[model samples]
Target: MADLVVGVGLRDGVGAAAVVTAVRSAIAEIDASPTDVVALATLDRKAAELAVVRAAAELGVPVLGFTAAELAAASVPNPSARVAAVVGTPSVAEAAAILGSGGGELVARKRARDGVTVALARTV
Candidate 1:
């Protein structure tokens, strides 16, 4: 398991470079480093997104995916009704990070770049 889990939210057709940059930036936002991250997480439907898969491969981590309803159930610091309308969950990056950590505190809030969003959570 990861000491820190990285949650990612990205649009279709996004590039791997953007995903990598977003994740790296989020990791940098907190005290943790990339090595502390063990997995990248997102909505299950997006888990196989080309950018997501490629980025995780480049980062040397696996991907953990959750269903929309599962993500909706997770409490998050930031939520958007617009996101809920589109993705069926108000929180993706933040909630996925929290859930990926198997219930932990958010270490870094959502950070977006080039249409990719990332959040970090420290495992309990």
Candidate 2:
């Protein structure tokens, strides 16, 4: 099986419960387990997000933060103008996942729930 990377985005005040729920949903779509995940990625501004940190700790993976420019440079299937206006990135979860995977193929697009978003990618 291919190694996977998961990228996450969450609204402020989101908790680990919501993050875990969203991540589980995304990985389930690709039949991946926590053990299959190599890392988690998100915007650098959110490096201190407790939800992201907790999720990474729970899954036993490191969390990587990407700059807005790096995330914006990634090609994502779901670009959002609203996100661009707020974070200077069109697609946080998808872009972070793609970039964090080092040009890996996106296996799951953004999956959102309870103010949390998740996407998965696999290195090719």
lDDT of 2 by residue, 14-105 (tens): 99888888887888777777778898899998967888889889888889999999999998999999999988989899998998899899
Assess every candidate by TM-score.
Answer: 0.95, 0.95
Candidate 2 residue-wise lDDT at 92 = 93
How many clashes show up per model?
A: 0, 0
Clashing residue pairs, backbone N/CA/C < 3 A, model 1: none
lDDT of 2 at 84: 92
Candidate 1, TM-score vs. the true structure?
0.95
Writing each residue's lDDT as its tens digit, candidate 1 over 56-116 gives 9998999999999999999999998988999999999999999999999898888788998
lDDT of 1: 0.90
